[model samples]
Target: MAYLQQAPAWFLWLASLGALYVSAFLPRLLVYLTHCLRRPEDLRLRYGTWAVVTGPTSGIGRSVALELARRGLNLVLVDLDAANLHEVSGTIMSRHAVQTMAVVFDLSLVSTRKGDEALRRLRDAVKKLDVGILVNNAGIAKPGAVFLHEADVEAWVRMIRVNLWAVTEVTAAVLPGMLRRGRGAIVNMGSASSEGINSFPLHTMYSATKRYVAQFSRSLYVEYKSKGIDVQCQAPFFVSTTMASGFAAAWRSSALVPTADTYARAAVGWIGKGSPLCVPNLRHRLLGWYLAAVPGGVQDWFCLRENLRHRKMLRSARSPRASACRPHGHGIPSIE
Candidate 1:
């Protein structure tokens, strides 16, 4: 009592502020570390017997499908490419000995009745299964960076349709069943572009769409978490796939730029854990933590400069002079 009475006011204020900071940040840090230490549970028991993965033919989607199969869950593989979907289904079945079904539906056409029809088909395909997980992984970004006014209107619209609308529509279609079953998980693929304080200048629409996913996922989490549903939006950067090949050539294989398979192996362990908004890739999450320390304006400028450099390099590579330098047997890589 005597020591407390003699304590300095400034020291008490500082101690209070320190406690306030810890109260705000410590729980999240503990959750993240817990998610890191434990592997995801058995999907068949945790959610259900089946999991659906959209855009399952390639990239992270394909890897997620395979990883889910490895965990002994039947799969419903959805993609626009029927041939590719079939191949992925066959591979998963043969490798994991799990039943697999492929649903070919184009998410980019959601603005029209075409997308509606595709969703109908997807619903019908999964109507008989005990689907417990939906991975909204199908999304697209244009080839080269451009200002909003100069961008391809049709492509930009398609990007919005696929990245934003599809997520909403798909979740709506799938959520009722999850609610009925009393257990389910929805994993929306967001981007690190809008994670934390980073702002992508030239990639405006894509960033906006991802921001929508993050918000939607968090809101849905609050709404349905008590009903035995897990909705999460994971933001990852520079995944080494056809979609990101335009950003950096070395993205082919690097610790910072993980291949889809490698990223998925780590990401799957986080499926039904952590905050509704997640950065699944460990390296990318660490980078996000580092970037959080920098001033917001500086982060924006760095992203803007990087995007500009990438756009210039892409333009040069597509120019006639650079095209002529290619070897006879070589061809430009598909940027997806």
Candidate 2:
């Protein structure tokens, strides 16, 4: 009876501790659980399939291509780098003994009338194959501080062309066949910035393009998920590929930096499990959850502060000599 009477004080303290622990660890635990429950059977590929992987010359795209080839899928490797595309195709064919076709065209420029013609040619090339998978991984990021008047206008347009426009075009090109066959998988490579507008500084254009990807993926998932077409959007954080090595090295955090191969494996694994959106690294997954739970105003403030900090760091890193000697010519944005 005495113990019961005194229990309220102890119980309150224990409850407070429980709440704190949950606040800190529940999201991570849930993400881990979600991954655990996701089985390969939930998202299995039919044997002897054909897949089209864009930007297969390097980075995550190359890793994805190798993964698909290893899974016994015939591949159509698409990239602007003809030499690298041929080399990669040859390597995959010799190593995996899988049929591979190389399609060399700049997907980023596939917007003009000539670009449309090129897309038609590429489409025709793949039309003969039994393409069951479409991996829209081609993307580009411009190096700039912000989407302001100082930024290169053409660079912004090119970023949109590669990151957003190409994804839409390729997905549309592959849709009819997938719908007709009543079985296909489309994995769009989104980024962590898509969840929030101000996820990174100097990434304004890239972030906006990714936001489009996230929205498009959600809408398509709702419209076609029941039609036997699996549409997934993978929003991964920084991977230690050449594409992101500079950023990763500047930050120098291994836990936050996953390798391209690790990212590819987790992404492909989740695709096989039919996950609509996959964020691989545990820390990023938690950050995403926290960002989701927070208010929009708070997120905006956070982003603004982060941008200011990045700007300060960037200013400190630039030397007067290098700044004076920097080239004035406009350069095209490239994902690789």
Candidate 3:
């Protein structure tokens, strides 16, 4: 008691430091112990079964389909563009020699009644295959100013239908089989904008839809983790795809834009790891970290200014008779 009472300040400081060290290491030690006690399946490869990839005609979706085919997984490719669908499917079949099925349907057009019909068709088509992977990669976005005065409500509704509703519909169609099989993986293609941004003024509806996808994936993971299902929300930065060519050239220099193949490869790697959220590229990871750590008001101020500048650049790119920038020598296709 006397020794304790008379202990030097430096001695107390040293003791405190030792305690902190133990506290820091204890969690890791416990985790290691728990891991050792868990079943081998907990650490084994969870990918490589029958897979479905939406929007598998171009960009990231096509890349993912190719990568999965290379891994020896049979694929079901979904897309609205029948011509591109045929092109991509033919390429994958000839290159990989994997069994491939192509389905052409506008998921955005399927309502509750139509969704039932679509789901029935999808179910009937894949009923024979042991599907273990679902890539919800279909989405649409319209480029414009953010404010209601400039925003197109019809376009916003269409974007929401394609980006959000289709994900729900497809997942609902495939989840039951996965649950019964006791093993599966679902990867939802999200956007970096889902975390909320003050800088990009025109993506209000797009960002909101992406946020919904992220949240939905998280909730589904929590709900189905015990059933041997892994859900991953992949949020990637600007890619050199036609969809983002204008934005990439305006916001980030061409040197910084990642190609669709790069993003797809990284996303597959993350899926293999059973990661809950995959953010490709170090720059995007750092940006997410900083945005989450910064004060809301300060982030908003910076974001608003950046968004205004970005809007101006997009407007300039949209000038009549202006030539649309091409990436990878592929001219942008007219959707209309």
Candidate 4:
């Protein structure tokens, strides 16, 4: 203290500026460290006996479901593919020694009262279980760049139905039970595209829907934090999974693009803590900070260029010449 008081004024001013700069990221760094150091919560004790995950057949959802099971929580796994859903549930049951229920229904089927029926079925299935954690992880993205006016009408609408409507309806269905019980956590899967980029031109609808998820989750958190519910919107840059397999080779896991399992483990630790909007990966958090410092026009140009490059690669892969060289009957399933 005596040494600090004797320090030159110029040095003190510089030290204060450095401290302020570092303070911006200190909280997030502490959160990451705390997650790593602490033992994870017993889901059964912290939330409830059963946790529900949508899109649990593959990718991030499957990883999170397995993690929850490992934490001793029974699962309600929802997916459109009955076979895949059963397969995932069976694996979790066998390895984790936890019970799992597979609910097979298409979230994008919003015609002829099908969407209503699907939600009713989902609500009924979940209501039977003491669901404590809900992960709204189901979403769809258009594969390439096409102007909104040029895109297929049916496919675009289907993206909206699955990405936005499913999240809202499923949350509505499960939230009442949580309110009555007075304890639960909700994790809404989002994307870094919602944060870093100025505009995701190729993935316009998907980006817009994710923005909605972030905003909705924040508002929900404000409304429910005192009521024993934790809501988080997690926006990750990338994960090496089937949904991201096309770009997997190009973008490997780091602190930025963590493997699905790694990300799931980290994400579960923040279930009932931190700000409502979370970018779980350290690299993504740093990147978001950097992007925010960039001028808006520069961010816009970068996003446009990056998405256009992705579009070119997708088009080339789907070209007739390229398709002829691939296996005769195999195709990447459209489910994810």
Pick the lDDT winner.
1
lDDT of 4 by residue, 24-135 (tens): 8687688777766777667788789999899988788889999998889899888888899879988998898889888777888844387778778888988777899999
Clashes of each: 0, 0, 3, 0
lDDT on C-alpha atoms for all candidate structures: 0.83, 0.73, 0.73, 0.80
> How big is the positional error of residue 314 in model 3, measured in Å on the Cα after superposition?
4.0
lDDT of 4: 0.80
Candidate 3 residue runs with Cα over 4 Å from true position = 1-48, 112-116, 196-200, 246-250, 254-256, 272-275, 290-295, 316-336
Output the lDDT of residue 85, model 3: 82
Candidate 1 deviant stretches above 4 angstroms: 1-30, 248-253
RMSD of 1: 4.8
- By summed lDDT, the worst window of 10 consecutive residues in model 2 runs over 39-48
lDDT of candidate 2 over 269-308, digit per residue (tens):
6663435666755566766665665667776676666556
Ranked by TM-score, the better of candidates 1 and 4 is 1
**lDDT at 136, model 3:** 95
Ranking by TM-score: 1, 4, 2, 3
Worst 10 residues of 3 by lDDT: 35-44
lDDT winner between candidates 1 and 4: 1
What are the models' TM-scores?
A: 0.88, 0.81, 0.77, 0.87
What's model 3's lDDT at 49? 61
